[model samples]
Target: MTQVKLANNQWGYISAVIDEASNEVVSLNVSNHANKQQLATTLSNLQATIPKESMPILHSDQGWQY
Candidate 1:
């Protein structure tokens, strides 16, 4: 897992992935003003990108999003 800061303030996210099996990218793009509608797409993006058989243990710091 890895993290990248968003240009927007108070609005942040952490990206995680199955690194060993594949360089999958799981980006949790979040915002302080995010709502339920936004959440679905964000989660969907992560789910869609992850490799189905790649179960690499997700790792990350104690990020506010993670």
Candidate 2:
């Protein structure tokens, strides 16, 4: 997760999922809040791109959103 400052001093949060083997971004989400919903949406987006039979290992910093 990363935080970015927008114009007028607003903030945006970025959430992303990467494929380790391919070194590619599999999923991404940006929002004003970095909460559970944001994480959920990121994972949900990733789910749509992967094969149903593939069980990919997910690694996180174990932050609150994880």
Candidate 3:
């Protein structure tokens, strides 16, 4: 996760799930803070839209938000 600065200097974080094969964004969640809950929300949204049997392997780095 990374911080995004707005026009007013407010910072927010965005977690997004992308379909690498399709090069498309499948899900997105934005919050003022980057944390486990934010990541969970993004993943939950993605799960709701994708089929369980076709679920892709999720990957993450060493970031705490991941």
Error of 3 at 20 (Å): 0.5
Between 1 and 3, whose lDDT is larger?
3
Give TM-scores for every candidate, taking all chains together and pairing residue i with residue i.
Answer: 0.38, 0.88, 0.84
How big is the positional error of residue 53 in model 1, measured in Å on the Cα after superposition? 1.3
Query: For candidate 2, lDDT tens digit of each residue in 1-66?
Result: 888999979999999988989989999999999998999999999999999899899998846787
Candidate that beats the other on TM-score, 1 or 3, i.e. the better one: 3
Stronger candidate by TM-score (1 vs 2): 2
Q: Answer with 1 or 2, whichever has the higher lDDT.
A: 2
Clashes of each: 0, 0, 0
User: TM-score for model 2?
Assistant: 0.88
TM-score-based ranking, best first? 2, 3, 1
**Candidate 3: which stretches are off by over 4 Å?**
none
lDDT of 1 by residue, 1-66 (tens): 133456664444333333444565455554444345445566577677768996645455644443
Q: How well does model 3 score by local distance difference test? A: 0.84
Error of 1 at 55 (Å): 1.0
